[model samples]
Target chain A: MIELTDVHKAFGSKRVLRGVNLTIPTGTSMVIIGGSGTGKSVTLKCILGLVTPDRGKITLDGQDVTKGDRDAFLARFGMLFQGAALFDSLSVWQNVAFRLQRGAARRPKAEAREIAIEKLRRVGLTPEVADLFPAELSGGMQKRVGLARAIAADPEIIFFDEPTTGLDPIMAGVINELIREIVTEMGATAMTITHDMTSVRAIADNVAMLHDGQIKWTGPVAEMDDSSDPYLDQFIHGRAEGPIAAVR
Target chain B: MSGATLALAPVAAIGRLAIFAVRGVSHVFRPPYYPREFGQALMQIGWYSLPVVALTALFTGGALALQIYAGGSRFNASSVVPSIVAIGMVRELGPVLGGLMVAARVASSIAAEIGTMKVTEQIDALVTLSTNPMKYLVAPRLLAAVIVVPALVAVGDSIGIWGGYLVGVYHLDFNAVDYLKNTVNYLESWDVVSGLIKGAVFGFIVALAGCYHGMQSGRGAQGVGRATKSAVQAAAVAILATDFLLTALFFTS
Candidate 1:
């Protein structure tokens, strides 16, 4: 379980996150939906310890995330960045096997490569693609490769940031299905931030709508369509006018 | 801007760079060292840079010989060409020019590569993978630059002196034996040692500036471009400034 309480963050004069309080129960898929630049990424980064909050308490499994062994804390979580964030210098398999190649999780090179190939296979990529670089792959393939890397370590928690942002609808559906299947199979607590309605429908067990740096509405996916909150309705229905302004 | 804020901006920048340098250098002695990354950096910073460094030193040395011969002739002392060329090449020109040339080549490359990584969020990905970017990226490059740059200076110094020998013996109708003898007799061990030390310091500055700017790069192509430009400019100025300070420390009375 991950919990954030009263998280407040500001950059210079811009307040990005103000009093954000949220929780994800164990073994649940919670997808956060929001317009661009509404602090969705910031919230994810804060949980990952990439960005520190000005005032907040974030805990993972009841342990404060800010005050602990960073490596040990990070090893339990896997993240797929918005851009896929693959290392351009490394080959696909090397990127997948990165965690196994060094630090406390170090494994033999041959074994790591074998596991990388297996994970790549799991993500619909062939073993041959393991030797290729990230640049050689198509956009959708790169996203799959990123997915493979995220699940490579079989982490207890996984984060997906804008997972289907740039893909075609068909590819987006495939990725959404893959994400849904993976979360179900691994039983890992998943926190995904995306605005794709299709992705939300396919992958989210619960939906949280963020507007103006706060969660405006949150409910189970079954109840999301009938929530009746004007902000949530405007956002989900893609309306340009409502309590939430179209432009900041 | 307020007067106090303007005054403190440079101090703040210096302080930030100092902290970054300390963090980067501290990672050098820690565990989980990447030998392959260090080896690749060595080849990139040292081996690949040889041709450019050699060519620059050769021309500078030949040009110095001609200029020294011309100036010395006014005093009826043209015989001083080989000795002056040798001392100048070993004590100053070889390292300074070699450092600057490398600052132009390797520093810019490092900044661009790492800055692109930053824009792409690859550094954050490394953090998520339980790897420290300072250890995986900065330390290996820093170690390679500090270690291999002095060797390049040694090679450049030898090539530079040889260039002067060629110009002195052939171009000016000087006796080859006499020129070599003058060069050998006039150059001291401290001259070469001092230049090598300068090479190490310049290498440190180049890598430090590159990593610092690369890490601080904002986002997008413009940010990466600015980081690369700033890195090269910072490295070149740092090389010259450090060269002056080292020279003052080594040769001043």
Candidate 2:
């Protein structure tokens, strides 16, 4: 389980997260939905220790996330970035096998390549795509390669940042389905941040609505439709006029 | 925009650069070195920079010889051309020109590439992947530059003297044998060694400028462009300044 308690963060007096508190249960997929620039990514990065909160307590499995061994802490989590963030200099398999090729979990080159190929297959990429660079692949294909790299080390936790942001509807659906299936099969704690309604419905078991740098509503995805909160309703239905202003 | 603010800005920038350079150089001695990254940096900063450095040295050496011969004729000292060309090339021109050419090429390239990687979150990805960017990225390049630039300077010095030889023997009607003897006998080993030392320092400056500014770059394309521009400018200025200081230390101090 991951717990964030009274997390507050401000960047140069622009308070992005104002006392955000949330809990994600073990072995579940939690989707954080918010409008653009509403601190959804900041919340995720805070948990990952990519961005430090001004005041907060974040714990992973009863241990503080910020205090332990960094490499050991990071070794347990895998992340797929919004832009895929694949290393352009490396081939697809090399990118996927990056973690396996270094540090305490280092493996032989052949073994790492074999595992990378297997993960690529799991993500619907052919073995022939392994040698190609990220620049050679389409956006969707690059996202799949990113997905393959994320799960390459078989981490205990996985983060998907705007996983389906730039894909077409069909391709987005495919990625959402893959994320949902992979999270289920791996039984990893998953935290995904996205405003995509389709992705939320497809990949989330629970949903947290972030508004004004705070969680306005939190419940199971099944309860999201009838949550009875005006903010949640306005956001889910994509209404322009509501208590929540469209323009910041 | 105030006078005080303007005055303090450069001081703050210098402080930041000093901190960055010290931190980067400190990483060079730490454990968990990446040999592969070192090898790649060696190839990129040294091998790829050869052509530009060589061409610059050759032309400067030829020009110096021609100018020296012209000036020496009025003083009835035309025979001083070979000795002056050799000494000037070895003690100053070879390393300074080679360092500047490399600063223009390698520093800009490093900054742009690393700045793009930072903008795209690749550096963050490296962190999440259990790799330190300083160790995996900057240290190897720094070490490679320090090790390889002297070798490049040595090669540049020899080629520069050879350029002078070509101009002297062919264009100036001087005997090839006497020109070679004058260049060889009049040039002390300290002159060559000092320039190579200067090369190593210049290399350190070039890599430092690239890695530091690149990591400190802001977001987007304009940010990357500024970082690249700052890297080359910083490197060239630093190389010239350090050259003067090193020259004083080597010859006067």
Candidate 3:
């Protein structure tokens, strides 16, 4: 389980996260949805230690993550970056096997390549795709490659950042289903952040809405539809006029 | 900016750079060294830079010989060409000019490439994959630059001597045997060794400046552009500063 207790983060004089609290239980999928520029990425980055929170306690599996052994703590978690941030120089298989061939999981190149191919297969990618560069793949295929890479080390926890963004509806559905299957099959705790409701419905066991630098609402996915929170309704239904003002 | 603020920029930048250098050095001894990444950086920083350094050295040596002969002609000391040209190339021009050229080419390239990756979040992806960004991205480049730049300076020195030999024998009507003997007799081990040492320091400066600016880059297109410009400018400035300090230390006695 991952827990954030009243997190606060500021950049210069501008505060981005303000006393935000969130919890994701073991073997469950939680999707945090919000409009653009609501500090969604900042929240995820704080958990990953990309950005240090000004004040908060982040605990992973009951251990204090902020003051814990970083390498060991990171070993148990996997993340899919927002842009499917694949290395252009490395081939797809190499990118997927990156974690499998590092630290405690260190293995021979051939073995790592095999594991990469297997994960790619699980994510609905062919063996030929493994030899291709990231620039050669379409946006959807890149997301699949990112997903394969995320699960390559069989991590106990996974964080997906905008997994379904910039994909067609059909491809988004495919990715969402793949994420759901991988989380369930591996019995891994998963946290995904996106504004896509279809992705929320397909992959989320619980839904949390991040707004005004804090989680405004959270409930079971089944209860997501009937929520009385205006923020939740306006965000889910994609209304322009709402309590959440457009940043632009 | 005020003159006081402008003057403080170098001091502040040096302080930050020192901190970054210390952090990177600490990371090197830590776990998860990526041999593959380092090998690639070696090829790019070291091997690929050779031809350009050689070309620069060749032309510089030739030019130095002609200028030396012309100036010596006024005093009927034209025979001074071979020895003076050889010493100048090895002691000053070879390493310093080669470093500046590489600072222009390699530093800008590295900063632009890495800054783009940073903006695109590829470095973050490496972290998420449980790979250290310092190990995967910076270490190899740093190691390769330090090791390769010295060898490049050595090769450039040899080519530069040959360029001077051609200019002396053909243009100045100097005997080949006498010119070669003068160059051989005037050359000192300390001179060559000092030049190579300077090369290594300059290479480190180039790679370090590139990696530091790249990692510190902000969002969007302008951030990347600034990183590239700063990397080249910093590398060039460091090379010249290090060259002056090394020269004073090496030749003061």
Per-structure clash totals for the candidates: 0, 0, 0
For DockQ, candidate 2 versus 3, the one ahead is 2
Question: What DockQ does candidate 3 have relative to the true complex?
Answer: 0.80
DockQ of each: 0.93, 0.82, 0.80
Ranking by lDDT: 2, 1, 3
- In terms of TM-score, how similar is model 2 to the real structure? 0.97
Worst 10 residues of 1 chain B by lDDT: B82-91
TM-score of each: 0.99, 0.97, 0.97
TM-score of chain B, candidates 1 onward in order: 0.98, 0.97, 0.94
Tens digits of per-residue lDDT for model 3, A20-136: 899999999999998887888999888888889999888887888777678887888888987899989989999999887778888898999999999999999999999999999
Model 2, stretches more than 4 Å misplaced?
Answer: B1-7
| Candidate 2, A128-158: lDDT as tens digits | 9999999999999999999999999999999
The sequence of per-residue lDDT tens digits that candidate 2 reaches over residues B1-253 is: 7999999999999999898778778889987788989999999999999999899888888999999999999999999999999999989999999899889999999999899999999998998899999998899999999999988888898889989889999999899999999999999999999999999999999999999889988999999999999999999999999999999899995
Task: Give the native contact fraction of candidate 3.
Answer: 0.87
Q: What is the C-alpha lDDT of each candidate?
A: 0.93, 0.93, 0.90
Model 3 chain A: which ten-residue window has the lowest total lDDT? A239-248
| Candidate that scores best on DockQ | 1
Task: State in Å the error of residue B8, model 1.
Answer: 0.2
Number of the top-ranking candidate, with lDDT as the measure: 2
- Which CAPRI category fits model 2? high
